[model samples]
Target chain A: DTAVSQTPKYLVTQMGNDKSIKCEQNLGHDTMYWYKQDSKKFLKIMFSYNNKELIINETVPNRFSPKSPDKAHLNLHINSLELGDSAVYFCASSLRTNTGELFFGEGSRLTVL
Target chain B: SQQGEEDPQALSIQEGENATMNCSYKTSINNLQWYRQNSGRGLVHLILIRSNEREKHSGRLRVTLDTSKKSSSLLITASRAADTASYFCAPFTNAGKSTFGDGTTLTVKP
Candidate 1:
């Protein structure tokens, strides 16, 4: 079984549309994060949640929101998606917030045309 | 925003050869870690070296951290085709914030 799993492996939508990507981890991690890898391959941290509490919120647009229903699930919702929003979104989790080792799910590639 | 920056944006090597990638950060950290991302896949943690540690090894991978210089390096020995992937270094702040580098793409020719 996958330690971390994300849904909508590939998402293609028109500009101004809204979409969401779901993630879950079977590892029973206390921290989860959402990272975006742009065309230039820069992995930027968008948000982080620890035990369902928001911990890290980078300089991302307000259109991007992270919802953690529980310690094991973190979902990202994007509103009015733009072409620049197209990128590979990764979901990751760690046993503890301080641990450097993260378990990542197969990325969800989103394309806003 | 990203914290760590890796050198040699890309690297190419033949099987059985060794691949090395370097990363430099701007702030103090509790630990530095390396990760590998295969094409179209999520990144996998390769190794981590604490600020108090100089070097660490796992299988054919070796990682070294120099907290004083705020840099780290990942070395893959006896590289194989399967070893081809983008290697990234992430230095975590004492507050537990982690930022990944741009990554060094390694291509191992069969």
Candidate 2:
């Protein structure tokens, strides 16, 4: 089974459209994270959740919101996406908040035209 | 969160050659980890080295940590074309956050 899986492997939408990506980890980890990778392949952490609690929130815009209904799941919703939002979003999970190795999903590619 | 800055943003080497990448951080850290991401794929954990450890080896990979200088290096021996990927070094602080840098893109020529 895939340890960490994400839905909608690819997304293409208009600039003002809103889209959501879902992530789930079967590894039973306590912490999950959302990362955004730009065209240069720079991975930046957007949000982090530990046991369904928001533990880390970067300086991302309000248009980006993360929801964790449970420890095993974390979803990201982008509102009124802009052309700058065109990038790859990755979902990752770890055993602890800031320690250990991270298991990452295949990622969701988002293109805002 | 401590982000490790990787030196030589890109690297190219022959299949039988060795490749070395370096990472430097500003503050103290609990441990450091290396990850490899193939094109169009997610990052995969390569190895982890603790603050106290100076050197570690896993298969053909060797990692060294110098906490005094707050830097780490990853060495891959006898590289193969499959080793072509972007390598990232994440420096983890005890303060409860891990951050990665831009990463070193390694291209192992056939």
Candidate 3:
């Protein structure tokens, strides 16, 4: 079984277009996260949710919002996407918050023109 | 601000050789974790070393933590081409936050 999965493996959109990426984890983890990996391969943590509660919210712009309907799903929605939004968005989950290993999904690549 | 920053942004070694990557972090940490990411793939957990621990081993991979120096090193023995990937270190603090570094790109040539 796929432990962590993200939908829309690839996304290509124009500037000002809004898009959403969905993520689901079956590991029964209490914490889920959204990370952005830039072209330089630098991974940055965007948001973190523990048991459907917002735990960590970095300095990400308001254009990006993360919603967790439950403990198993966390989705990211970008509004009026800009060119700088082009990168790989990864969904991860762990047994707890700020500790233990993280199981990551295959990642969703977003390319904005 | 970033917590952990790996040294030697990139390393290239031949197969059967040993590769070493170092990570330095600011402030104290509860634990440190190492992860690997292949091209176009997600990061995979490799090992985790706690603050009280000094050394840990998992198969051909060895990790060492020095809390006094605030540094850690990951050593891979008998590296193969398939081992080529970017290695990242995440230093987790007691305040419930961990930040990943830029990562060390290890290229094992066959």
Candidate 4:
């Protein structure tokens, strides 16, 4: 089974447009996360959820919203996408253990022109 | 917003050699993990060492953690061409929240 999977591996759009990235995991993990890795190679966590409930929402802009329909899926939607949103977004899942051994997705590259 | 940082932004070595990367964080952590990212793909979990644990091993990868110093190190023994990738160490704490370092870009010449 593909443990963690993300859709639209590549996205190129103009500024002010809206785009959404989908993520799903079959690992039976209780926690899922969304992370952004920019051109500087900095991976920062944007949001986290456990059991379809919100947990950690970083200091990210309100334009970025995360929706978890169930425990197995988490999706990110960016409204009025700006140039700064162009980065590789990754989705990961773990068992909510203190160890934090996350299984990551292949990433979705978003390029805002 | 302090996070973990890896030493030596890049490294080049020959096949069968050993590659070591060090990571230091600014905050206390419950555990630290190492990940490998090839090209622009997702990160692959390499190994994890808890705060209470001093050392852990997985095949060719060995990880050591020092909670007092708030640092960790990942050692890859007998690195091969296939091992060439960007390695990142993330220290998981309340504030850090499993953050990634800039990563050590490794090039193994076959």
Q: Candidate 4 versus the native: TM-score? A: 0.96
Worst 10 residues of 4 chain B by lDDT: B93-102
Candidate 3: CAPRI quality band: medium
> For candidate 1, lDDT tens digit of each residue in A30-64?
99999999887789888999999999999899999
Tens-digit lDDT track for model 2 on B1-110? 67889988999999999999999999989899999999999999999998889999999999999999999999999999999999999898875577789899999999
- lDDT string for model 4 (A1-113, tens) is 78999998999999999999999999899899999999988899899898898888889999999999998999999999999999999999998745378999999999999
Provide the lDDT at A2 for model 3.
Answer: 96
For every candidate, give the share of true A-B contacts it also has. 0.80, 0.60, 0.66, 0.72
Please give, for residues B5-74, the per-residue lDDT of candidate 3 as tens digits. 8988999999999999999998988889999999888999999998999999999999999999999999
Q: Return the lDDT, model 3, position A17.
A: 95
Error of 3 at A26 (Å): 0.3
Q: Tell me which residue pairs clash in candidate 2.
A: none
Q: Which ten residues in a row have the lowest lDDT in candidate 1 chain B?
A: B93-102
Ranking by DockQ: 1, 3, 2, 4
Model 1 segments more than 4 A misplaced: none
- Residue A8, candidate 1: alpha-carbon lDDT: 89
- Superposed model 3: Cα runs more than 4 Å off: none
Candidate 2 C-alpha error for residue B4, in Å: 1.7
Clash totals in order: 0, 0, 0, 0
lDDT of each: 0.91, 0.93, 0.93, 0.89
How do the residues A1-113 of candidate 3 rate in per-residue lDDT, one tens digit apiece? Answer: 99999999999999999999999999999999999988877788899999999999999999999999999999999999999999999999999986778999999999999
> What's the CA error at residue B25 for candidate 4, in Å?
0.3
Measured against the true chain A, the candidates' chain A TM-scores are 0.98, 0.98, 0.99, 0.97
